[model samples]
Target: MDPTDTAVMIENYEAFRSEISLSKEDVIRELFRQNQDRISIKKEATAVRNLIRIIDSTLRLANSKGFHAMTLRDLCADSGLSMGGLYAYIRNKDDLIHLIQNHGFIITRRTLLHYTRDVPDVRDRLYAAIKAHLYLSELMRAWFYFSYMEAKSLPPQEKRDAVAIEREIEAIFLGVIEAGIDAGVYQPRNARLVSSMIKALLQDWYLKRRKYLDQNVPVDDYAMFVRDVVESYLLQA
Candidate 1:
């Protein structure tokens, strides 16, 4: 099970993306269907469908205009939902941001854990983690973009939660590196520190994608490059 040098199917991010293929409607329903108390949105099929429209529109508008600059009226107009309907989803702008952030975290965290949970080898696990994260960020670029840029605007507790989420992701990478070290597949190093570096590189993929995209770097290319560099560093004598 030593994936340190042997050939294996290191497919593109698209392969990871396909494993968690979810439609827009499904995301909305899955996010809001549980918050009956917090969100007044009805649970009917059409209502759940419209909730997706509302979330999609809110994110779009919030991304275009700063979340602070986006008003309830703008959300209503963009989402094609009246104030009453919008209120059912969120009480105010703060609530709106909370809803969006929570939903994004749930999906991102779940996807990462699911795809990386079964990797038998630490090297393969690391590769899958990197590819899953990069592809998820690519597929939900707007969510990642909004979360990063607008994070400071969130309330103190919410901001803490955001940081915690980031650390949790880093911990996943840390676990894989530690496991590799334990199995003598990777050279010893500070696993946590190394994981943080890996997380930083992965974050840059979503944060400064324009720079990479300008150079015509594709996700698969970036994923493989990351895998190569990380594996090379880990396997050093």
Candidate 2:
């Protein structure tokens, strides 16, 4: 594929999906591995399956009724796991919050890096980064919404961790824009500001999805629209 050709470079959600594995099982497996010491479940397969249920139910409950208001009892009922079974995965609500936050961050960080890291053409890389975010958010809309909504209630350290995650993702975009400017593919401008704007645009899709869904706008279309808005300021005349 000619990376420089915008027409050819554009990719849809299906292409992004095939290239990246962000399934619930895939993410939960990684999550279980990362938190094995903390997760009392000894068996990988059982732990991963239960983690999926716990995480999915958490996102659903958190998005619907607010994370702070959600109880472990509610989680157990919602996920169809006994209280003892839920404890095998998470000790407390705070622990559950951390699990949710970390898993979402891990997936988001990995998705952006996977799509953009090896692409040589900066513009194509930027589009890939943008599309990766929008598509991933669309897939995990509840997680994204839950993370944003519950961030304020996070403990001091976890809140800082959440902020760091946002900056790290933004830095990925900044790196691409700076590369484009250095290569003269994009105009000389405030790359940092541009990156922040890009993040806000991407966040809007998940945060305000009701509005977009109300209009029946598809994610692929939203991806192209974001690329257009971003590239308009990026590309030189």
lDDT of 2 by residue, 27-131 (tens): 678888888888888999999888888888988888888787889999999999999889888888888988989889888886777667778888889988898
Which residue segments of model 2 deviate by more than 4 Å? Answer: 1-10, 18-23
Q: Tell me the tens digit of each residue's lDDT in model 1 across 161-219.
A: 89999989899899999999999999998899889888888889988989998999999
lDDT comparing candidate 2 with the true structure = 0.84
What is the RMSD, in Å, between candidate 2 and the native fold over all Cα? 4.0
Overall lDDT per candidate, in order of appearance:
0.80, 0.84
For each candidate in turn, the TM-score is 0.90, 0.91
